[model samples]
Target: MDKDNDHGKNDGEQRLESGEGDTMRAEGRFIEPQEPRAEPGQSEEQAGTGDHATPERLDHPIIEEPHEKPEKRTTTELLYGVIANPVETLRYVAKHKLVAAGILIYVAVAWIGAFASIPGSLNSFEQIPEISGLPMFSPRSIIVFTIVGTPFFSLLWLVVYAGILHLIASLLKGKGEFPGLVSAVGFASFPMIISTPFSLLDYVMGIGISLYGLISLPFTIWTIVLTIIGVRENYNFSTARAVWTFFIPLIALFLLAILLVIGIIALFVGALSR
Candidate 1:
């Protein structure tokens, strides 16, 4: 009986020990897990599971720097800039040369038509004698007059003429592609069509006495303003510089006219002496 009691006590102690071991194993399983360790040299930021994992703070500040806003340009300032840059104005003209050429062709055709209509009108003035002391009324006379006068008027027209071309090109290319001098020349000449009315009126009223000069004045001023603007744009010049450039072509034109007059006078004298 004593042996049996001792064996039963030993069996109870073994069962108690076994139960304690099982409880410890179950407790270990119930506890939350720790995050796995990252590899060496790997950043915690890259792991994407840090204490600061909220979306608002998740984006790394180092990747994005703030940008500055661009300054705005006023219309007056833009106009002034265009005029100061003549080379750019000309370049603008050259780019759209086809359009410019088309306008010139149209003007030429109109002038031709005007000439064609002149003969019937002139018939009302007088009849021709067999051989009058004065030169016969020929269409060539009108043609000669046009050839001589057109260039003078055209030169004056160049002020705005070059400006208009430059303006169009610059505007079309976007403010970024600032035009050159060729563009100014090409584009600006479009408005010279305005001068056609002056010629027609001159023909109808007999040249020197008509309101043609008064009518052309506004166009002349407009062209000058445009040329100045074209120069400013191409060159990126100041307003003062643009204003100054407006006079440069005029001065050049004046000097050229003087030279031409002197050459003509010299040639006339030489011929008279011969």
Candidate 2:
């Protein structure tokens, strides 16, 4: 009767141990066991069944798959892509820092526009009945000034505009660099290229500047929209944040102007009272 109790107690202990081992394995606290091995002078079944048996655990290695690279876009494709897939295209421009290409596109458009305006300017003079001779600011001189000034002013404006947007975006928790944002905003002006043909038509057909202005109005608005998109993508910001970043500088300037006017009016009132 004592022998039976002793055997029963051993069996209960073994069951408890097995249950713990199984729980550990299920919870991933222990690695899975390898093939069971027999002890010296012990049968495989006896070794596997006994408490002294502890099979080795095998550690599996983790393998990571490589990521695919983004496709490279040519300058032409990038310009077209702005219209087709603005988000991805602007992101690529910002990531790649295509500053030169963007600046070139803007400057080229400005130069073309300056030249196109020459025809209209000359035509306007011809329409006036009062003046037989060229005025002090002659058409030729104005043309020369326009052509020479377009490149420098356009390039400077691009840099300054990009800088303002970058600063505003940074204030809004943007993570983009100035050069990247320059490229982004530069590319954002891609939609303005659509007006080139209209300018060309105005130049060749002697259409009034009014026609060009009418045609460019919608495209100008579109360029502003693209600028907002570029800011959003470059800075990884939400649409509202990007819009705020774009407009904040403009709003500040406007408010400053108002304050200056008020100050001037107050000073004039003080002078009048004196």
Candidate 3:
């Protein structure tokens, strides 16, 4: 009996050592090898929950930003820049309080220059005495009126110019301000100051009004050009609109004047016949 029991134990040991335990499956499939066992009271699946964590993300796209504009200039710089680079100066003047300063400068220059050049314009006037009947326009009275009323004239001009330009610009879908338009018109008048000296030269040196007019014509043209730019810039409109804004009013005034003269003549004829 002892010999038979020893033989059965030996056969069992041989079967285990021959890899029969490895072929055993839990649910009709071979068991996969696993990591070391978890701690006390912890299952392998529960331990894996602690091991899994949120990952870091870094795949977002970059975004861009806009740059800033340049700083503004001073009133003096804008004054000098008017005839030099009118568009830039008008832009500067429109956004600042420089319109007041510009209008003041124009009025002062015009007053003093007119007073200074009386001798020349008077000489020119005396030579053309063919129309002496118009005594209200004597050289002395005209000088007095200009000296006393230059500020008023300048202010009136500013209002009219700014008003017309703002209206036209608004009609054309522009987004300009009235104050800025005033500054633009005021600064556009900067070129007028240039002609003052030449007028004085003609008066003092007696170079003749023709020469003075000839020399000052370019400055007048410059003033007109600057004005056109000012209107264009302040209105933020096309060059064509700016040109029309300037000349239309003047043309209308001329037509009105001709109509008035014709009406007055017709009235006088009717009165004489009656």
lDDT of 1 by residue, 1-274 (tens): 9999999768656755878545645777323445656556655554546454444565645455568754544423433433465344344443433343433533453455355445433553344543222354455665565666554455445435556444544443423222245445334433445665565554465555236667767766766666555455555556566665556556768999999999999999999999
Better of 1 and 2 by lDDT: 2
Residue-level lDDT tens digits of model 3 in 77-196: 877788577787787777664667767766776676667677775676677767534675687687777777777886776787678767767777777788777777777777777677
The candidate with the higher TM-score, 1 or 2, is 2
- Cα lDDT tens digits, model 2, 1-274, are 9999999768756855879657756787655557678878876655657653333421333456788887788999998898999888998998899989989988887787777667666667667756526563577677778878889999999988888888889888998888888888888887777776787666588777788889899999999998998898888899999999999999999999999999999999999999
Best-fitting candidate, measured by TM-score? 2
lDDT of each model, Cα atoms only? 0.52, 0.82, 0.73
* Ten contiguous residues minimizing lDDT sum, candidate 1: 170-179
User: What is the TM-score of each predicted model, taking all chains together?
Assistant: 0.40, 0.68, 0.64
After superposition, the stretches of candidate 2 with alpha carbons farther than 4 Å from their true spots are 1-65, 125-136, 200-211, 260-274
Off by over 4 Å in 3: 1-69, 121-147
| Residue ranges of candidate 1 with Cα displaced over 4 Å | 1-137, 140-179, 205-210, 252-274
